[model samples]
Target: MMLYLAQTTGEPTGGLAGWAIDVIDALGGLGIALLTVLDSVLFGALPIDVLLPLIGYTASQGAINIGVAIVCAAAGVVVGSLVQYTLGARLGRDRARALLVKLPGIKPESVDRAEAWFARHSTKAVLFGRMLPVVRPLISIPAGVERMALPKFVVLTAIGSLIWNGMLLGSGYLLGENWHQVVDIMGYVPYALLGALAVGVPLFLRRRNRRRKNAATAIVETNTSG
Candidate 1:
């Protein structure tokens, strides 16, 4: 993705970037906004692996224009999130529970914990979740299931989505030609975090199981001695 963006914007093939810039310029206000919204919603909903750098590079080259891109992307994100939330709400808790039971490696208790968290901090969770990589999409599912207020959800989601998208686009713009490089470097952050969790999880589970076993042995010893 980074390479594609770079190649598209590079001198030899800079025509691609020029073409995009022309289109955005022609669209003026409304066209740019529509592009921003579409790009933000569709890319935001999908995995960040491909979308972030693409947007970053394009934004950096001024292909999409920063201000217009931000507004459009924010709108797209909020709209996509609302769709997910509505579906979850329509399905309700019972349907959600049934689906979870059939899915492997999904802990019902984890879903419960998420629900509890959302109940206590729906607005904060939903807003912050929009900035996170995978959590952004997942958070909406529970919010919908809980039937959170529409106004609050839209307000929070829009604000967070705008800030998050703005940060990425702004970063690219500021970094200029090297914006793609910056995005490439930053992309590893998520992968590294995931790798740490993969290794840490087993160690954590092993320690937990050991503690449980020791506690059970202690109980048996005390009963036998008594």
Candidate 2:
């Protein structure tokens, strides 16, 4: 597999992205595993969504096996998340959050929200949380603080990671060389969703208000008739 990775080369892509590609090309599955571990622990710094697809694209070009890439990604996730889980379990909530806050790019409020998500979802938070942005990396900490069973946590994390990683990987495979299009399009997703909410929320409120007014009018008319 490492030889396979080395054989597949491209014109140099500049910047951090280029550096990442070089690393993966040089190190193969080990590179994927290490990057994913960072992705799992470092909040949004590594951009796994973009990286996974690139791996897929490489696989499409017959560089590395997609199945192996997915496995490596998932394994990295498990290892990174376990690091966080252990911290939470050992340090407890307050101390863990304090330490996490000191880490680069980690927000204190994000930690708060992750705890809230766990409180609401309980055991299944591990499953669904893996799919959610922002919450994905932090969810493991709360699970640790609460001392959820290691076996259950591992199962849920693996299943969720596999589903998410597989989708990204599959998308890359399908898109072929145009996989960068997915990243470009994804950049606008947040804005698109916000635009939808901005339009939909007011429209929904207006319709709801109109319905209530009509219902009140009908009641008044019926009382008068009576």
For residues 126-155, write the lDDT of model 2, one tens digit per residue: 886776677887999999999999999999
Candidate number with greatest lDDT: 2
* Residue 136 shift from truth in candidate 1, angstroms: 0.6
Note the Cα lDDT for every prediction shown: 0.62, 0.80
Q: What is the Å distance of residue 96 in model 1 from its true position? A: 3.2
Quote model 2's TM-score. Answer: 0.74
After the best TM-score superposition of candidate 1, give how far the Cα of residue 118 lies from its true spot, in angstroms.
2.1
The residue pairs in collision within model 2 are none
Segments of candidate 1 deviating more than 4 angstroms: 1-50, 97-117, 184-226
- TM per candidate comes to 0.58, 0.74
lDDT of 1 by residue, 85-201 (tens): 776788887786676546554456655655665675577778765655545545676888978888988999899878777777677667766665655665565466546656875
